[model samples]
Target: MGGLHADHAKPDDRPTGLPTSSATLTPLVVKMLRHGRIAAEHDLLDIGTGAGGLTAIAATRLGSDRVTSVDIDGYLVDAARDRLAGMGLSPHFVTQDATDALPGDYDRIVATVSARPVPVSWLQALRRGGRLVTTIADTALILTAWKTPDGGATGVIERDWAGFMTTRHGSAYPPGLDELFETAREADGENVKLFRYPVTDIRNNWEVWSMLTISIPGIEVDFEETPEGRTAWLAHPDGSWARAEATKFEPPTVHQSGPRRLWSELESIRNWREVEGGLPLYGCRAVVTPDGAIHLSRGRWSATIG
Candidate 1:
């Protein structure tokens, strides 16, 4: 999660790296699209046509005319179109951003990118009784919602967890928290103490990290290994930072400072999860207002994101 730059979607051949669009679609993709419940007669709009894995599957299975795929990078669309055509498969490939006016009439939509507030354009583009499958950005929480009568949607955060790259409006993503990570690396403070919990990389723990992203918001994580032990660094837009270090499977000495004690809050959530057996984020109801605000609730726990 640290010391590296990343692309939101899968590998693409934008005159950069990799070859022709992926012809050998992986099982992971098969499962991902299967969750969309693609049927022979279903009209599908596939978002983030990265590597053309899903595009190939959809076109081959449902026929090219029944499937439409879009990507922000025209090069990706062009590359995928040419390669799929080489294999006698051609789906409508649009050179447009997925967040904008999607270029298709679809009864089922599957996005390989995450959306923070689940775009309203998606709802507008989906036909009546249509289904949408995507993830909430910054979290591995999968959302599968169906169109409602009032131009809104209702669904759930699936019991399962998976993710893709976040949605982008251009060729690349915005600048990230490199400055914050630099600050976290060079800072000296006395907020030191040993913790009972082991030094764990929160990013590797899907449930906790996802829930923390929901509860804390705007937190960026970095991690690395050292001769002494493993270290995890957390930073937020509010100028908060926390670092924890320890040997394998051992208690960590923590250092933290800022308006909020980021590590302390994470520990609290972790403890809460332990006491309650599991986190409430999974298997919760997700309701999308017409304006695209997502309201999620499960029993007594609830949160809203826009």
Candidate 2:
């Protein structure tokens, strides 16, 4: 599925209880198909059947009998079923949590939504030598792996970046970090330092953003251009917060509070990239063990996600 924000004309009017802002775009569906390397004979599992667009396409490619689509929301499932039915197609549509046990073993599993440390059930359901295409939650890292004989999967991070809404357990997602955000807004941080670099918006920098998400999960960031300069705020669930301001070629003035120095961590990653030329997030080797741990290795550095 696409991102969680709706594509309504009114910015304040977003659909509730929906899996994503919109159905997976056609180009992205094509990309997933290309990366999945699906075959006409392969039985495919389409996780997160948001609007049935991907399911329809798969059904059209492979027979409808060979396609199974699932989602957590009954409403979405029914809607997707109806949409497909209208087009004279009836792919299997199941209403179940993507993280939960799936129905049948398949040769290909493609998830439009993102998952953290991909669910173990996916590996179990995937037929040996089958491929699974998905993105990691909160990051633009797209992973496509082939199931191995040792009950593990090995793959490389694709150089292309794409993000989808994180998987949800219910009709709607839980509330965001409102209380934590409010606290981070005014708390007197533990330390402050001058950032000897130009203010940079991390969101626009996909490589750094992806690396940071993997290294430090649950960090929320916001940036805007102000009369004072380029201003940015970084907040963490653990009460860490930082405010930075800079203009043109001048260094940034930073104010930080809370236990962790969030800005320092960001700067450290940036410094590493400055020295290394690029982050290891892309083109890295990913190994998913039977226990649901995702290990990423590139050069001499490695990290594990459980």
For model 2, give the RMSD to the true fold. Answer: 3.1
lDDT of 2 by residue, 134-180 (tens): 99987888999999998879998998988888888765677666676
The segments of candidate 1 whose C-alpha lies over 4 angstroms from its true place after superposition are: 1-25
Report backbone clashes per prediction: 0, 2
**Model 2: which ten-residue window has the lowest total lDDT?**
1-10
Superposed Cα RMSD, model 1? 4.4
Residue 213 shift from truth in candidate 1, angstroms: 0.3
Error of 1 at 269 (Å): 1.4
Every model's Cα RMSD, please? 4.4, 3.1
Residue 111's lDDT in candidate 1:
85
Assess candidate 1 and give its TM-score to the true structure: 0.90
lDDT of 1 by residue, 1-306 (tens): 111123334465233321222233477677678778878999999888877888888899999999999887676778789989999998899988788887757899988778988888899999989998998888888999999989889999988877667777655566667787787777863488877788787887999999899998789898888787898999998888988888987988788878888888889889988999989999999999888899999999999988
